[model samples]
Target: MLEGPEIHRALTRIAHEVLERTKGAEDVTLLGIPSRGAPLARRLAERIERVESRTVPCGALDITMYRDDLHLAPARALGRTEIPPEGIDGRVVVLVDDVLFSGRTVRAALDALNDLGRPRSVQLAVLVDRGHRELPIRADYVGKNLPTSLRESVTVLLEESDGVDAVLIGPKRERGEDRTDEARTASGEEN
Candidate 1:
């Protein structure tokens, strides 16, 4: 769906869009969810710093503890949630995530943020918005809007985690379904 260069361009645009929407980062803070969102947040902060010529505060937010499906799934290790020194009490807090699927994660993030502190406003920034929204959630800054099927799967691989930066959309394989070259090529994955 997106390659490294595409991802870079998207982040750049998102950074500018964010500053424009908030009238600059004077009252902004970016909090990324764990896994891929953490580095994406840093990247956005870097871009914001370049455009604004000022460092933007960025931190990691772990929503494992606050997820609605925690009991439905097996137990996993909790992620780290760190707020900046200035805090989110009165800043425009942007929740950064790699992809927006069902909106449950964002919903959980909101619950988690509620425990932290009240922000002047809350916004969402996502690299890709794959349309299959299970809740009434929207992204303030979207890198791309991808329309996909419920039977499909979108995977975002970043260098920090997957050693590559690419967003691949492919069909979800069932048991005994062979991985074909067609799927690999279409998904932008090398066999």
Candidate 2:
């Protein structure tokens, strides 16, 4: 699992990689998935600005309404979507997220983005890419390539919300299993 310093380093590296991949961040919009990614997007934009001296557009996008598993998944609060003033049309939009698991979220994000506008190009950037992607989607820029089991869950605790920065990985209990206990960080010791 990733710690505070680790997460910071990853984002710094990711920001540089994004600029390199997009060729100087021109017409680029960093659209982050709701919750964790929104803050991460702002951090990435700041890092990019340090190098380029020009600010890159940042926005928050929520895919709850566009998800395909609504019928099966539990109901949750819908998140707000805020697009940048520049919009996504004719720009390079990089979708940012904390973790990549089954890739369903990215799929939903793609749909949500399509409804917003047709970007000249879209790319993906994630802090962690845990294997077992149910969809064919893959991240273009990844901070870390983490491997996790289907029975395990990866929760990214950002300082913005959790008050501490760390990645928690633990057994994912089913409906009948006990869910009272807390999860632990993997720390890349025992995946």
- Top candidate when judged by TM-score against the true structure: 2
lDDT of each: 0.81, 0.80
Q: Give lDDT tens digits, candidate 1, residues 9-69.
A: 9999999999998988888999998766888999999999988899899999988788776
Name the TM-score of candidate 1: 0.89
Per-residue CA lDDT of model 2 for 1-191, tens digit only, reads 88999999999999999999889998899998877778878889999999999989999998878877667545546655889999999999999988888788889999999999999999999888888888999999998998877878777887886789887777765532321222112211111
Per-candidate total of colliding backbone pairs = 0, 2
RMSD of each: 5.7, 4.3
Cα deviation of 68 in candidate 1 (Å)?
0.8
